[model samples]
Target: MKTYLPSTSYEYATVQKVAGTTITEASDVLAAEEPLEIRLGYGPAGQRQHRTLSITMRTPGHDFELTAGFLLTEGIIRSRADLTGILYCPDVAKDEERENVVRAELVPGLSLDLPRLERHFYTSSSCGVCGKTSIDAVHATSCPVLPTDGPYLDVAVVHELPARQRAAQALFEQTGGLHAAALFSPAGELLLLREDVGRHNALDKVIGAALLAEWLPLHQHVLLVSGRASFELVQKAAVAGIPIMAAVGAPSSLAVQAATNFGMTLLGFVRQQRYNVYCHGWRLVNQQPAGGPDKVA
Candidate 1:
């Protein structure tokens, strides 16, 4: 396993706490949000070139993994072999811009399709989920069909994941302002937890971390999101080949469709003793459909 480098998650802010009748001033911690610029560097030896890929509003750290995972999910690059090196640019022309930019050097001969990439942003913080509208849906290209023969999970184990994910949410506990995504083993062990201001970004962080650890094609594992499962989250999981995805909140309409079409087992409203499996029910051992004869919408 790769040892993840620790990153700071919060900054101090002054606030007023209200009681039954009195108000007390207090200092509180808040999740930090910042813009990160992603640049892709490619071509051969002396003629290497760099292009601004994207800039996103994100929490300040785990940046390299975020960019890597974003590129992969966007179909820009595949495996770790596609990268020669990744580092935060230390020499921006402006002093304040230095640490906010990361340059990913791609291996020789590979090229980026700019027109296709333009469909994503031309690269900006306002870049939508797939660069169309707000981060509302997954790009069709990002989510291909997933494997049907991935893994089986019991309903009992599915219910256990949200609590496990919640236990590792240190930043959320402190600030309550960030969304989280966690990767877990089929046995319900937490593998990785990534927190972010946006739900999509959090999933990207987790997938990116898995990629760096050479743990891609998560066929036998589960992904538990602290928030609702959106199409973007399901797409990220499908791209990473995770067989199951559970959400503490709920699944969006597009998310349910995507999960059903992609052969992924998606569940929502995971709580103490029950959870609703949205689709691909065959993968849940000893589980049955809830509604007796509800018509398929």
Candidate 2:
């Protein structure tokens, strides 16, 4: 853990046999949930400026990436060059809510239109984009055209994703209340995973980690979610240029629509041995026998 300090108490669960059935209850206690305030800085050297952007309810560990990814997806900063540095406020330790505040300093000349960003508040990783007045608005800030020749994954690799995703969810193993988001290579190797009480938070954590590592435009990786594929999750992946997305649960109509619009592959209901390909079925390699002709895999 970050070890800054904790405020509230968290109750980790324990399972018990009640009569004939096995039930779980909170008994062992752990650290509390941490809230982080994201701040942005801009303008000239003599009059450098900073503003409180938003307070996100999250664990304090990945604060930097969270800020970077937030700026990227919001279309505030296109590349890492736009940011000068990301750090906690100097007096954070003196503040009781130290885990609740962090700051990101931007490069000089990076301008932000407050009104435009305010309108974008309705569109975030957690919330779907439905408040648009017209389709033109969606076109204005939609995901950029991805490199069409990104890496490809074999069908067999996708079949193994459910088990891989489940194996990485340590928090979910204990609480059963959290959602997980993971990234895998085209060959089915696990790259990164994060668990959170909110589905969107999990995805954000992954995006933030990638941003911190300067790994935006994650075109070679496939994103996997432990739960249903929501429109917002697909939006985040598209923004990061992840070409393939899979989930162990169902996908909403909007999620499917977003994937189709972005030319990204969306997979859903990916259990142990079976999965439903929502879009871009052509990416799956042929699974035909050696002596047979080309066939759909």
Candidate 3:
């Protein structure tokens, strides 16, 4: 594995600030958005095959973790043992190009279902996969149904997560443009956090870090996102075996359905002193009944 260096997460830009009638030019911090190409190296040892797996626009940091997480969540690779090494593409001529491209080497002769991978990429790129098909695809993967036995979280703890996540968002404080994903214990202690311009990428980085550290199947932890919960985010969390997920913003209808199907607790609008429990509310303690109408069939 090549030495991994941190990439610049923010950039400096000159902006015109308008306050009342006065206008002044000042330096502003902007979150960096760059394209990262993920490559896969597989096949036999002496004769290896390389392919560009994906290219994504993300904040230029935690590229390796992002790559790893993408693979796992996409159902390309199951665990860290499948990856032989991850490194920046050293074959590139320019240093800048090299950093933007990452190569994940798979263990020699590891079986890969190429057609499924291609179909997945094609569906995602073309936006042709319907909601049902997408959900069905997730079920087709090795993602397991979340357990309901334990790791119950307190309502107070859930309420404090947004503030805690906000306070620890160093990059977001600088640019105010980055999204963040954080993992916390049931007692509300922050464990791992990752930030990026894209919400999915941020979650991918967090999952990737945990995957590399052999801390996967995060069934005992709660996941928090700085933005609205999407189906993709819920899918990734479910694949990682996260039992509970909270978002600062509202969740889409599909997100709720997917979470419901997976037996994962989904919380939305987790701010101020309260939040909405979309499904599987049994895992939350100190919670009163919503007393709303019957569930829509």
lDDT (tens digit, per residue) of candidate 1 on 197-221: 9787888888888888898778878
RMSD of each: 4.4, 4.7, 4.2
Evaluated against the true structure, the overall lDDT of model 3 is 0.89
The TM-score ranking, best first, is 3, 1, 2
Off by over 4 Å in 1: 1-7, 122-145, 288-297
Better of 1 and 3 by TM-score: 3
Give the better candidate number (2 or 3) by TM-score.
Answer: 3
Instruction: Give candidate 2 misplaced runs (Cα > 4 Å).
Output: 1-26, 29-32, 92-94, 122-128, 131-139, 287-297
Each candidate: what lDDT? Answer: 0.78, 0.75, 0.89
Worst 10 residues of 3 by lDDT: 288-297
Q: What is the TM-score (0 to 1) of candidate 3?
A: 0.94
Task: State candidate 2's TM-score.
Answer: 0.82
Return the TM-score for each candidate structure.
Answer: 0.87, 0.82, 0.94
Candidate 2 residue pairs in clash (backbone atoms < 3 Å)? 37-100
lDDT of 3 at 123: 82
Q: Which model, 1 or 2, shows the larger TM-score?
A: 1
Q: Which stretch of 10 consecutive residues in model 1 shows the poorest summed lDDT? A: 130-139
Cα lDDT tens digits, model 2, 181-236, are: 89999999999987666677778888878877888889889999989998778888
